[model samples]
Target: MPNLQDVILYESKHQEKDFVQPHSHQTHQILYVLDGQGRCQLNEHTSPLKPDSMIVIPPHTEHSILAASKMTVLILEFSHLHVDADTREFLIKPVFKETKVWSLNLFVSSEIRQLLRKMLYEQSQESIEYKLGIKLLLSQLLFILMRTNQSMAQLDSNTLRSSWLKEYIDSNFYQITSIEEMAGKMGISSRYMNQMFTEVYDQTPMRYLTEVRLTRVKKMLTETDLDIVTICFEVGFESLSTFYRVFKKQVGVPPNRYRTTYVGMSDE
Candidate 1:
């Protein structure tokens, strides 16, 4: 009964059917895995899912889903309705490393999980207080998600060295590159690499890597039809599980559902 409209929730039991193909949407999507394992094949990237993971799929990215097991996913789709710097950057811009798209962590920590649960519980409430309460809670949760992802890059933050590091990440994230190798290649110590991105992008190179990956994965989600596993390797991710974790952390919605929203929105 849940598609990308209003406050929707997906409670499918063993969704083995192929409900759709790769597509894009008018509304942005958010998905949280309540339970079970799954795979998100976004454009050319495929990510394997785990319980408690969350994903954000930017609007207009074509993608599909191939569930690995039974799953309960909480899905939210909202129009291009909010205005803020965060909302603007989130609209598929180069400020990617500057937005939630650069998420480098996915553990929903107890704090965020609890907040999400509370909002979901209040979704159907019609009272003005309940509606405002949900909005405020959602904003807090978004802030937490973005902030946590930003903190994960504190290993070697450097603002002074951003020009060099940003160039490298923008050009070469598709290969098997490590933070150390990238730092060495940049002619600076790894510590400096971390510092530079924080300085330049307000995020570390490692954090930018996740953003780079998601940005490209988003390309695949919008333009291709590859399966989730194939999409994962194409994006230079070795394991499906790791890709899923990182993808969910950044995009905030399952790839398939995100893509489905695109198709659904276009039809409307």
Candidate 2:
């Protein structure tokens, strides 16, 4: 089930100067280029786009694209669960620089590329539950992109310590992991990790960790009916106090109240 919102997809040739109309969705939208090029003006930046690119736009921020070539694009619109105040803000916070482009790893193993091809081909076929195929394939596409983006970051880094630290976060992020543990595993001090992470990511290690945890927790809260306390523990917050504090500080509400807001939400 889609926790954040419904899913939609389109692959069509768009004309130059054709606009999608300046609009925002109630859920996040991801645009994956299948062919051609374009310019995406999101927030304030305007950058040239290319084929095999991906852009994730969070909810309710004005954005648009200008076709640079006859464009073939695959678009997915989905909602978030557990999108509590904290997660909500993070989602709304820019995931990427506005008006930037990210190149996909075309060198992804042949099997993975074949899978994507199958999805796209199967999608063009008709089925009573065609959406099922769309969802499954899109999920695969996203997982591959997420993993590739992370690996690229690791490779582009110059330090062995940096690579290890990032790998540890990627591996252990699902549970209640901490920067100190990240530092410990990297055989360095948390302070040292923080300095490097800040230089590399513009955010402290702990801050990035909190952002990841909070994003996952929000998904849980919105998607599952797990009790608040249980959800907190599941997402890796040991103390309800810390959860509540972070929730309020970043998300702008307490947990219980945040959950309640979604309970009656029309879309949820």
* Residues 200-255, model 2: lDDT tens digits: 77787677777877887777777778887887787678899988899889888887
TM, every model: 0.48, 0.46
Q: List the global CA lDDT of all models.
A: 0.63, 0.67
lDDT of 1 at 239: 87
Clashes of each: 28, 11
Residue 160 shift from truth in candidate 1, angstroms = 17
Off by over 4 Å in 1: 1-14, 17-20, 83-107, 155-268
Worst 10 residues of 1 by lDDT: 94-103
Question: lDDT: which candidate is best?
Answer: 2
For residue 119, model 1's alpha carbon misses the true position, in angstroms, by: 1.3
